[model samples]
Target: MIVGIDLGTTNSAVAIWRDGAASLIPNSLGDVLTPSAVSMTEDGTILVGVAARDRQSTHPALTATAFKRLMGAQKPVMLGRTRFSAEELSALVLRSLKADAEAYLGEPVESAVITVPAYFNDRQRKATRRAGELAGLRVERLLNEPTAAALAHGIHQREDKEPFLVFDLGGGTFDVSIVEIFDGIIEVRASAGDNRLGGEDFNDVMVELVRGQLKGVDALPLSNSELREIMRAAAERTRRGLTEADTAPFSLVWKGREIRRDVRADAFAEAAAGLIARLREPVLRSMRDSGIRTEQLSEVILVGGATRMPIVRRAVTRMFGRFPNASIDPDHAVAMGAAVQAGLKARDSALEEIRLTDVCPFTLGVDTVEFDRLGRMHSGVFCPIIERNTVIPASRVHVFSTVRDNQPVVEFGVYQGEARQVDANVKLGQLSIPVPPRPAGTVRIDCRFSYDVSGLLEVDLTIPETGASKQLVICDDADAPDDAAIAARREVLAALKVHPREDAANAATLARAERCYEAFLGERRDHIGQMIIGFEGVLQKQDPKQIKEARDEIERQLDALEGERFL
Candidate 1:
């Protein structure tokens, strides 16, 4: 059976279509959400999800998070002795989610539909499909996150037929889209987003606040990694608390100096004020490009866990001059909608009547040379044939002529972006074809582009002069590893033993104590240090009964010293 997976930046989840409805499958921990964190322990063990996240504060150098922002980039993330691309880190998360889905369904799942930010470029989307393949699952479809959210919310709505908007602000990415539904048909009008903008930015703001204060008195006495993890843990706690309470205090100790500050809603809003401003531009652009008026939108729906923050809600309301609908859980909407899409792909009886359509989030064009009447030529100009937000499963063709007399070949550099210059756009791929030498502007070539709903792009070039043609399926081949390389990576991952599933609770407890021990000093630090050693010894015994007994005591001691985790 096919399943739906939401491989997100900060978290991941899995779902399946069952009993005529979409059902979210819980992970081994009996939770619907799993942190999208991966880490290598000091003993050369790889941990994913909860264990990895818990260890992040203690092992910052060997842990990687938020790599989703680097998707399609050339940079490599250095974690310990290895360098990994963004897709490789993402594949680990996907593999973990696949394991969870299989365990819950009691079956071996081989295919899935994964969701991505609506505004992801061609390279990012293709990389996501590659990540799924590396995880041993065939990606059936690449559904846009905002479009998936709409499907989840509008799936059972038989009475409401008005148009709405989906504002998705997750942990590491943001996407805004306008949606219209009529007669069991859902259509996405337009989309816009910032790949690097999200709730994590707010967390960074809190971290900066601490850094600024530390610089005021003296230079940091601790290592950069130590300071970073401490600030991340504290800031995240304060950020999550501020969602429900008006004030959350941030406190930490360094070199006998106590840093204490209360982060109130007003102060946080002031600190995160810039992020709020950035959110407006995308929404306004999406509406303007979609030719939609503010009054035409019957409702504005907020999707993504980041939307739960009051500041985000207030920002949305201020922009639209109306309150947004929060009936659907922002955290689970995307994954749930993915399940619906999975059902649609399978042609399930319940979803047989629902017809959904999406648009291309970017314009596809070729690098062309434009010659002026004065005999001046301008190169690197982007000639768009298919505009952004055009209905998918669509094709467009543009005819071009050679720039110079007897030009031997035509080099086509295909790009996907809004920039007017090819240099500013992302080049998905390129193809060069040899053309019979002809006089300038005499030979014509048909540049046809076809875009499908799955976010894959195909470019076809045909020369009417000689009936010769060339085509390029836009995909990033350089970033994709061969089957042998993929197998090698998998073997390495499989070798780095993940903490046993049954011992997750004990493993988490030990990690938390280690983090606490590193952050404290004086007698409190010594007490936690001994507690950690004791737990480690117990874990080495491999006796589940003994480990549980020791874990309860260790957790109690750490809780007493650390107070509440999110305080």
Candidate 2:
């Protein structure tokens, strides 16, 4: 059976189609949502989800989170003594989710439909697929998060035909999609987004606010990693609190003293004005591309957990002149919709009547040369073969001639974007084809681009005279690992000891206590330090009852000191 996975930046979840409906699969901890965090212990044990997230403040150097923001970048994340690419870190999370699904379903599941931001570029999408492959699952499809939400909301099942907009603001990415549904068809008219904008950026704003308040303090290890983590955690808590209350305290304890600042909702809104402004362009662009005015929209649906913020809700109201739809749970909608898509892929009887048609989020084209009226030739011009928002599984062809007299080879640089100049667009790949030595504009070549339902691109070039042809499939070949390399990395991951699932509560409590120990000083610090020692002694005793009691007591104390986790 194929499961649906939401491999998100802040959290991840899995779901499956069962009992004629899509339902979320609970992990070993009996939670449907899992924090997308990974950590390595000093003894070479790996940890994922909440246990790893708890270690962020205590074992900052060994923990990695929010790596999804760098999905396509060639960056390395260091955890303890090991260095991992973003894909590898994501694979660890995917592997954990796979295990959870298998355990929950009592079957061997190997295929999945993973959700991604609609605005993700080709490289980022490919990286997501690669991450799934690394996790020992065959990635059946990469579904757009917003589109998935539409499916999960059962928009296609409605008898009325109407247009709506999906505003998706997740942990590290933002996307806007214009959709229309009629006659059992859910059509995505347009999609646009910013990969860098999300809830995490708002957290950074809160972090800055707290730092400004503590500027007068001296000799505080503000630059320390653990302290940074502590501040981030505090900011997340305060942000969540501000969702319901008009004012929330952003406080941190250091050197036996508590430094605090009460942040009003207005102040946060003012400080985050820049981020709020960034959400406008994509929304406008999506509407423009879809040729739909605000009045034409039947409803503006909100997706993603970040959309729960009152600040974002207010912004959406002002943009659309209506309260957006929120009946569907923002966090679970995408995963559930993905499961629906998985059912569609499996041709499940319950979903036999539903159909979905997606759009190309960006333009796909090749570099070209243009001659001005004065006969001056200009190169690096982008000639689009497939424009943005075109329905998927589409194929388009364009013809071109040789640019220079007797040019030995015709070079085609494939790019994707809205720029008029090729240099301004993202180059997906390039190829050179040898041609007959002919005068300029004499040799003609046919360029055909095929984009499939799964978002893969194929470029075909043919020369009529020579009957020569070539095809290029867009892929990140330079960074893609071979089978042997993938196997080696898989072996490395499999060889590491994974923390026992049953001991997760104790591990998480201890990790939080360690962080509290690092954040406090003087007597309170001493108290936490002693508690850590006592807890370690209990753990060493290997007595379940004793350990549970000690862990519960520690968690209660930490709750008094730092409050419960924000989630």
lDDT of 2 at 229: 81
lDDT of 2 at 547: 90
Per-model TM-score versus the true fold: 0.92, 0.94
- Give the winner by lDDT: 2
Which candidate's TM-score is highest?
Answer: 2
Question: Per-model C-alpha lDDT, please?
Answer: 0.84, 0.88
Off by over 4 Å in 1: 156-160, 213-223, 255-257, 433-438, 475-479, 519-534, 537-541, 549-567
Q: Judge candidate 2 at residue 307 and give its lDDT.
A: 94
**How far does residue 180 in candidate 1 sit from its true spot (Å)?**
1.3
**Residue lDDT tens for model 1, 1-567:** 899988888888899988899989987667788888888887877777777787777778898988888887789987789787888888888888888888888999899999999988877887788788878888899899999999998885644566789999999999998998887889898998988888789898877765666656654544578567777778888888888899998876665666777787898898889999999888888988899999999999999988989999998998889999999888899999999999998899988778889988888899988878998989999999899889888999999888888999999998888898999998878888888898888999999999878665788999987899998885434446787987887776666667666666666677677777767778998898888888889889989889888988887777787775431
Q: For model 1, where is the 10-residue window of minimal lDDT?
A: 214-223
Clashes, model 1? 0
